[model samples]
Target: MIADDLSSKIRGGELSPGVALPPQKELSARYGVTLATLRQALQQLEDDGLLSQQPGRGTFVAEPRAAYRLDSLRGFAEDLRAQGHLVTTQILGQTVAQPPAWAAAHFGDADPAVRLERLRLLAGHPAVHQVSWIHGLELAETDLSGVSLYAALAEHGIAVHRAGEALRPGVLDQASATLLRQPLGTPAFHSERVTYGLDDRVLVADRATILGSMMEIRTEREVSGLSMQWVQLG
Candidate 1:
């Protein structure tokens, strides 16, 4: 009962994100419950992602988590922005170079490709680190700083027809951890995608590391619309 009431307050916006709740003893008194009971209720809320508890600091409401839609064709930044979230992109690097050995397998070894590295932030917190290798396009860093990669590709007459992606659980490495402001070995989601253009030619190969604490993968199912498969990783 206590958990349900507190959850309702949170969902109704009575408890806003980042707002600290009253001290435990005070809350217990207000709710006519013992301190132990109050703590239990708070724990329930925390487990549900409605609150955040810092060891030395008081508990506060958790920031809303962004959803990464499994069925969407839009880029991460574009999808979140459409849901009224503030998303910013930082270009880590961009260069014309030989695709890495892994990417080279997809894009033949004959031509130089544009390699772009980007970091996406949600409400000023780092959320995703992505690197993309694009073949046949001469792109500059400035061309993608504030726009969606798909939108940028469209500007160059490239339209994404479809993409195949694979996802797996991962832990943040030193480089990714530093960029995401998380400790090394933090849990993360790793995704690789190969996108084809309307002409049926592969256009971009992308790899991304998403902070699991800040985002959730979501998809809706219909009678015949979308399906999912689970694979075991060794």
Candidate 2:
């Protein structure tokens, strides 16, 4: 009951982020509980990521975790920006090259693709490493620098209508680790996506490595007679 009450206050904005909790003795007195019981309640809230306790500074409401929508067709940069987070992209490399076997099969071509390597930063920290493969034959001389990849595609009348996506566990390679400022072999989420145009034509293939610590993926669903996917949260 104590934890629930405090959690409700935090969520209701009665206790704002970074606001310290009352002293242990005073809180126990207010709740008419022993100090041990009050401590237990506080510990439970801390475990749920709602509160942070400093060794000597006391407990305070924690900032909410950053969330990424897994059920959207939007770009990562677009999504993050909508949530009021500062987003930036650094183009690492851009060239025409043969894609991996899986990407080649998805594009239904043996020809090369325009490969781009980019690092996405959230609030000045590296959050994801993206590698995109666009059809080379269709865009032989297209310049991609200083523009959103989706915007560039839109210029050529190739808007992404729908996409197929999958996520798997990955280990950070040396190059990726160096760029992301993480140790090699760190666990990450590998996302693979195939974007389609209006006519159901494959437009681009994308692979992204997202840092585990920087963001979380969430999906919502409606539980009726049959389960159905619900709208995504920004």
Q: Which ten residues in a row have the lowest lDDT in candidate 2?
A: 224-233
TM-score of each predicted structure versus truth: 0.79, 0.71
User: Candidate 2's residue-wise lDDT over 59-141, tens digit each?
Assistant: 89976545677666787787788776778888888888898888899889768888888899887889899998887655546
C-alpha lDDT of residue 119 in model 1:
95
The sequence of per-residue lDDT tens digits that candidate 1 reaches over residues 167-212 is 8988999999999999999999999999888877888898999999
Error in Å for residue 230 of model 1: 1.6
Please report the TM-score between candidate 1 and the true structure: 0.79
Off by over 4 Å in 2: 1-65, 137-146, 223-234
Candidate 2: TM-score? 0.71
The worst-scoring run of ten residues by lDDT in candidate 1 lies at 135-144
Which model scores highest in TM-score?
1
lDDT of 1 at 120: 94
> Which candidate comes out best when scored by lDDT?
1
- With candidate 1 superimposed using the best TM-score fit, by how many Å does residue 113's alpha carbon deviate from the native? 0.7
